[model samples]
Target: MAAYRVPHRPEVEARARRQTQIARWVGLALIWLLVGVLIFLGERAIPDQHLPWTPLSVVDPIGAATKAKAARTGEDVAACRGVLAKGGLTYVLAEDSANGFCSVRDAIQITGGMAPLLPADAAMTCKQALAVAIWERQIVQPAAFEAFGHAVVGIEHYGAYSCRRIYGQQAGPPSEHASANALDVAGFRLANGEVVWVKSDWDDPGLRGRFLRQVREGACRVFITTLSPDYNAAHADHLHLDMGGKPLCA
Candidate 1:
């Protein structure tokens, strides 16, 4: 066996080298192609500083509020900001307050868009703010369009971030409003200056009543609690929305 060894051909070695070179080039091309694909997808994720994707469609300048919300540990607040920005709604971040048993954490005072100044200016927690923003965009705006052929211009409300106990319950537990986690919406002003009050419209069998009920039901998607005139006497004049405890829709 030792004496039978044969020398390799020069052409065979040359052919092998050429094949190896081609394989290497092919691998490099594939890597470059993948890199190009990734860059394209990254660009598409946010086009012209806007997110046109579901849920995130309302966020302009993607990841804009990610760090800010993370700092306050308010995922809902951050999301609301994105929605507001995307919708071209402007707002100002308000000062947070901690006063004895009452505090408004991660609060913001909405400055523009939707019910800007109805009854009063209210401070809201991140969760409450997000719930209201979503309710406005997904429910109120669309319903308003269908009913009045005009957009909603303002909102009336009982208030948000009240430092008080639950209404009607004289004793035990504090209300969600104690921490700015709830808001009471009284009515909405249309683009035509028509005001729809919950007290009057909640009982109507027309579009106004139907729109109110539609929004109340839609609020259940973002708010953990939604109460309407049908709930009880105390809530007969407004829609009570909150984000705390168990999920409830009345």
Candidate 2:
């Protein structure tokens, strides 16, 4: 018998090539799966301490300057207008909270970004107005009008919105003040022509202590965080106000 011969057919060769291609595809899929698993494991192994949330860098020099300017001019404007009417001044009338700059201007216009409560007509929020009214009737007005015989002056405040974090807090949630949810006050003025500045009075044992006590007491009914001169050097110039969650004074 002649030796049996096995002949290669084109169809058979094509089928073999297709099988090879399928195997390669399978291998690639497995590799991808392995990579995905490894990545998941690596993420699980990292510690939260090594990947903490960090606050954004400073970028609002103009805002800072504006705040300073506002603090200086806010009181003067209020005096000129008398009783600090809200819907009167051009800046107050044109304030569009949608625009960040305009909000700051409004803050400066009404409260100096840190002064006592404004008149109800010039208030940004009910809490703010209430606080100011209370302070004026119980503290500012009494001290200036009846006690000291002053004009019972109004207050100035820092704007209500910012896109930044609390000072010295590099890793945490967004600041309440940054979202139009908070306020930073620079100081207050008495109608007796007395200006009790935060930066200046923050460290004075007598004036600073009294101011902090009064503000803190008032803030309990308004802001969440009533940071004052006692909180830190940064707060030495203003009383931080937040109308968010529960009251937190520190």
Candidate 3:
């Protein structure tokens, strides 16, 4: 007599598949949770202003995380575009990719935003441009009204995307500007038609000083890196903001 075998059950197989999927999702969640923890510990944005990053964890224990990040970055840029449209912001989209040294593709040339602020012509990654829009909307305008009783009507910037090594050094890593990932703001024009230069007003210890400090700190919520006159002599004349994902908020 031949040995009898149990037949496969379709319902049981379906249950097993469901369990497998649940387990896979749980594992992914755990992996991202660990990354989130590391990000929280590593990020040092201003108090109450730490940015919620785009889940850009570099560790890919499963080896597929990189692909997932690429997909997410695309989604992030799309979301930024939506925000720009809804806010009535004005900008021109840029081509993707600068070079191996510059990761910015899908950049933008921002021409307008809250209070008519504009960036010098340069390819600013969609993420960086959106971050600036958010900063202006949520932080700069409100702070100006509160601190100065006037709205910020204009802003001045050195530029964004200089393609140089950090601090113009012949050696060392490329600066954030190399990839169009940073902006250097030099000053602002207020509703009262007063110009506040970062160099002159940074030490005012008055409403102008407080307003500058507030915006600088507020930028930490959007830009992962915010360097001001307080950071170093190189940044003494401007507030340097970048999406380098560093925990820097100087």
**1-250 per-residue lDDT for model 2 (tens digits):** 8998899699999999999999999999999999989767755774322222211111111121222222232334343233234322222332435443223333432434223344322334323332333343444444434433554354545655565555536666656554444556665566556766767765566744565466655554334456776767777677776554355677
TM per model? 0.67, 0.45, 0.67
Deviation in Å, model 3, residue 13 alpha carbon: 27
Q: How do the residues 1-250 of candidate 3 rate in per-residue lDDT, one tens digit apiece? A: 9999999899999999999999999999999999988777766442222233434321211122322332244348776676576667788877766665656677888777566544456568777776676677777888888987888887788988787888888888999898888889998888898988899999998888898999998776556789999989888899998777476789
How far out, in Å, is residue 50 in model 1?
19
TM-score of 2: 0.45
**Cα lDDT listed for each candidate:** 0.73, 0.48, 0.73
Error of 1 at 150 (Å): 1.8
lDDT of 1 at 248: 85
- Pairs clashing in candidate 1? 115-154, 115-155
> What's the distance in Å from true for residue 221, model 2?
3.8
Clashes within 3 Å, all models in order: 2, 14, 3
